[model samples]
Target: MTLGEGTHTIIAVAMGVDGQEFPSAPVTFSVRLALPAPQITQPEAGSVQDMNLWIGGTGADYSAQVQLLEDFNHDDYGYSLVTLTGGWGRLFNLAPGVHSIVARQTINGRQGPVGIAHFFKVRPSRLTTVNVEILPSQEVKFSGTGHNGATVVLTYVSGPNNKPLPEVVVANGVWQISAPDWENGIYTYSAIQKVSDNAGGWIPSQDFQFSFPVSTKVPDPTNVRASADYSPIFSGNGVTGATVLIRKQDGTEAAPPAVVVNSFWSSQSRQEWGPTFDQIVQVKQRLDGQESEPGVGVVVRIAPLPPVISSLSDNELSPLIAGTCWSGAVVNLVFSDNPAVHTAAISGTEWQFRRRTEFAPGVPHTVSVTQTAAQQTSAPATRTFEIRRTLLKPVIIDPANGGEAERDLRVRGDRSVAGARMQLRVDGIDTGPATLTNGGLWYIELKGLAFGRRILDAQQTLDGRPSERSDPVVVNVVLMPPQFTTPQPGGDLPRTSTISGTGMPGARVDVWLEGRDDFLLRGYPVDSNGRWSSLVILPVGVKTLQARQAIEQVVSRDSPPLTFNVVPAAPYIETPVKDGHIGGSAVVSGFGVPGDTVSIYLGDTLLGGAPVLEDRTWSVPVTLTQPDGAHVLVAVASLDGFKSDRSAQQPVVLGRYEPSIDSPRAGSWVSHPVTFSGQGRLGTGQLVSWFNPELPWAPNLAVSAQGWHGLSVRALPAGGNWCRFQQTIVDGADASTISDWSESARFEVLDPASR
Candidate 1:
């Protein structure tokens, strides 16, 4: 049976072997074909587009095999196929050209007839460009065209920023939009066009990436000013309707932004002062709230009122000029006919300058003063004055009175009549006379005056007329002190040395050695020509010497103190006489120069050394651990790394230990308890004992490490009133190998109560 496109019901019966017919229940269902509506959604029918085309439509029931047919009904060549899971399908990559497209849907083994056919043309994109213009005012003009009258959208990117402009409809296949109030700089833009209505969304136009730059320079501010109260006003040129901003040198806006008009912008002067300072100010031009580069800067300085001249006067003696100016300005004073320019530093807004040179009497002078600050000089302020007459008196300018004077004494005085004759007197006797020069100075040299305090006076004479004598001056002349030529202060010298210096001729020079009680004087006669030399001996250790010279019964002051040391010539050995016994070390001592180090030697072996003290003495306990024999001991003094000759040799014996019992005589009385004391070489293991059987043996008294030992015994046997002590050398812990005991030292023990 063939099934039609409608609902149907049927039943069947099976014939039994007996030829009987049977009937069963029937089922009903509808038979419908899964046809699809294959209308193209993108690259709408008959629309211009690129070679990349999208063919898509609804599919047949549950599952269908969909294929795009090129040149439908004419061989029906398949261009693309897609397996549709539902009733929808799509295809891509259709050949470029005008073509009729048909989609077929097949389910199972049955294929449905092709759906409604769609037509389209596949070609390269013609939406190739979008042009944008950035005007000097920062306004942007954008335009673009796309094939098939596609819709276009404009967008630009600048400095990592992208912004989309208004969308426009294509008129005659072209679209344009104008954007205003953009910052001046380079910009890159892209035109996004929709060539057809498709689910693929907007596509960027090919070769349509374009860029434009705004080249307008930043507006510059000019004629910036500030009033005395610090109120500020500024103006500048900028794009019309742009906001002009004024800022201080610190980069903070000085006021709210102002709008530009007629290509010029200005801020109204406000009653309130802006940041008032003598500094540069900057302004920036902005378009549509976008800031541009900084413009040129203008300096604003609202200067204070001119400084006041409080005091300006001239005096003949100690001339002074003073005034006040701006707190930080320098005051310069220039005088007429004077090459010296005086400058005064500003202290708390006050300035002053003092002239060291005295102004001539009755002389007219003009002085001008000005202030300089911030590299700008003010107008000159002037003053005129004349020097008044001062007191006229001659002043002595030579050796001061009562002061030391040398030979060729220059007797000079000022305020004398020019070319006048001047007479000089010494000790009431006229020595010489001199004529004053044109500069009112008179001087004369006096010679051959006796050594002693002499009175000097001077008077000026003109045309045989004499003036009153000036005040007298007293001076002393004598021989200078003698100085040492060799051995300077603090120098080391030998005991005998010569001391010399130059002194007055035929004068008596005396040298003095500083002692604890007083300075000891040694008289020596000077040569005829003032040179003196003397030989003197200085004691060892630190000694001080001084010298002075007397001429014509006048003695000069003592010279400076010369302090020095006399190093020792040789070392001295005062202890350990010839053939003396030395246990371990011998005590060697003697006197030497101070600050010397004395080293003691036994034959060729150095024992020890000690530094010399301030009293010129040194002592050393030198070790003598040599073998048992006589040794020659000597000492050498060393000062400042230099060694003196060895002292006289002395003999000493070593390596002999003397052991003896010091307590209890040969026969003596003693208490009931007895004590034994002895001396022996230290570390020799010497032991002491008592050998009276009736008395208890005394405690062993071992020799001390420091050369002395003692022992006491109690509860001695009462019967034996006398006891004897004998010490012996022992070996090891036991009393074996003992040397012969010392001779007996006997003492008797007695009861204290019985006495």
Candidate 2:
């Protein structure tokens, strides 16, 4: 409950704890109603109306004189006069534009804080008609016609707010305003005329609305073409300064951005690094830093180059051009003078065609050919040759003479006439017939040949007539490559381990380490039993190696890579050995490589590190943080950036014999399952002898690395009991060290029924 707004008397009373009552002095005061300030209510904010206006609202005091003011004045004739009536008042004929009404009341001859009403406006008698127009550039132009010589005001209306437009001019009943740039959105405009005589009078017209929008036209890329060299070029038309984005179907950018200049844009040529299948290309335009919708896409196919033509033979009667291309591609031969187009039969990526017409000797003819695959044509491959018949030597098409070839050989040669059957001989031994194909080319395939030098020759018989034997083509047959049988891929290997593999007998094997390309020619000779082994010094890191066989001057392909890791040798803590005793600060010794930094740990507590000496030994002295108890420790060694695994933990006693009951000290009592924990100079796996009449020592209750051990007990009499502990370290059949009996530590045993 709140007290009324007035001066009043307040009193208070209190009651004592013993029923005594106390009362405060009586405060006298007077009560009076607090009259509210005046407010204007008639004309709403931003409303367009005639010159006659009324501003009024509830709130004013009659008993203590209250008054209202518009624009901070109620006495001057230039301002609105607020006449008070009953608890409400009205200010008549208020000025135009924005105005605020405020009310103040005098109480006890003191003026109170004024209360203000919502802003209001008053318009003149005649309104001005407003017209709005939007230009091509999205510029807004506003015009109006009002009273002659009247100062017409134009305003931009957005939502419930009105802002006056600057630089508006009105002459001879005409007024206009223009904005060079405007944002895109729906807008409302209004015009007001001041009557040209009254400075404060303004007549507002009805709202005129208009909308300015951004351009939505997106240009499509045109004339997209791919050249022989795989360079793709395209052009398009769009708004000036608009950016064109070209991308492939895979969402990867195909070319750099191109800015439109004078409504035209041409993209720079983009080349594909290798063969590409048919893919759809898309393009979009961006204007004023805003991207438009993507345009229609264009599908384009990029052709790959055909196999190279290694050599060509010249013939007077019929010139034959043969080479290799992609399988299923149509091969076309084009001559400079002849309109007749020649085609070749594609057989397993090989194409051959005959010129048919005779060519003059010493005359060079420009010839070009193309290959078409999947309806896509390749760039023209051109060559120039002269016709001169003088030799009948057979030429090897593949695996040129003196080069290495596999055991299975395909002997190919060119014949001058059709219906010619050829015979092939390898090292003077008849191999097989060289069947003539429809393309006037002869070839023979031989398999199961021994690995060595192969001398090949071909003899052709035309119309049952045998021709002289051709020249011999010598080729070296290489053996099968070696395979890695040890240290499989991703396997772990020692730092200095042997790499062995199987290869041809007596064949020298060359080891190539990854990232060490300069060791290509280094060879390790293998034994004559077709087995090889080599000692390699690998660094402590991930290593990869491959091997190849090199017999005489020929080298086979490299074997698959073998990836492995070279790890550092692990170190172990030697001193303060497992189950041993240590007191105060003890030296921790470990074995590691020279210069290795060994980190020591005592049950997860780091004890710093020490560098190993040249004798492959390291020692670090550490203070035991635990008091007279067993503990476990480990050691790790790090050399360079390679670190070894943590060594096996060593459990040892950490302090001397200074034992005391850790819990339930002297004069305190404990319950059953009495875990009597106390520290002593006892080694792990050692027993503590308890001298107490209430309890007996058990042989199996040996002290662990943590020093504490538990024993379960049944109900015991509630009374004081004394206990003592003694520890000794004993080797097999011999006592090495013994600690004196610890000082007597006493505690009371509680009854199980009362616990």
Off by over 4 Å in 2: 1-449, 452-481, 484-494, 515-522, 525-531, 560-563, 582-585, 601-608, 622-634, 645-726, 729-755
For candidate 2, write residues 477-531 as lDDT tens digits. Answer: 8776776766677775555667788877667877777998655336777666668
The local lDDT score (0 to 100) that residue 712 gets in candidate 1 is 48
Give lDDT: candidate 1, residue 238: 67
The positional error of residue 435 in candidate 2, measured at the CA in angstroms, is 35
Per-model TM-score, in order, reads 0.25, 0.25
Which residue pairs clash in candidate 2? 41-56, 124-202, 124-203
Whole-structure CA lDDT of model 1: 0.62
Question: Clashes in model 1: which pairs?
Answer: 59-87, 670-748, 671-750
Global local distance difference test of model 2: 0.63
Runs in model 1 lying further than 4 Å from the true structure = 1-370, 375-424, 428-448, 459-468, 474-502, 505-508, 512-537, 544-546, 550-755
Model 2 residue 650 lDDT? Answer: 82
List RMSD in Å for every model shown: 54.7, 41.3
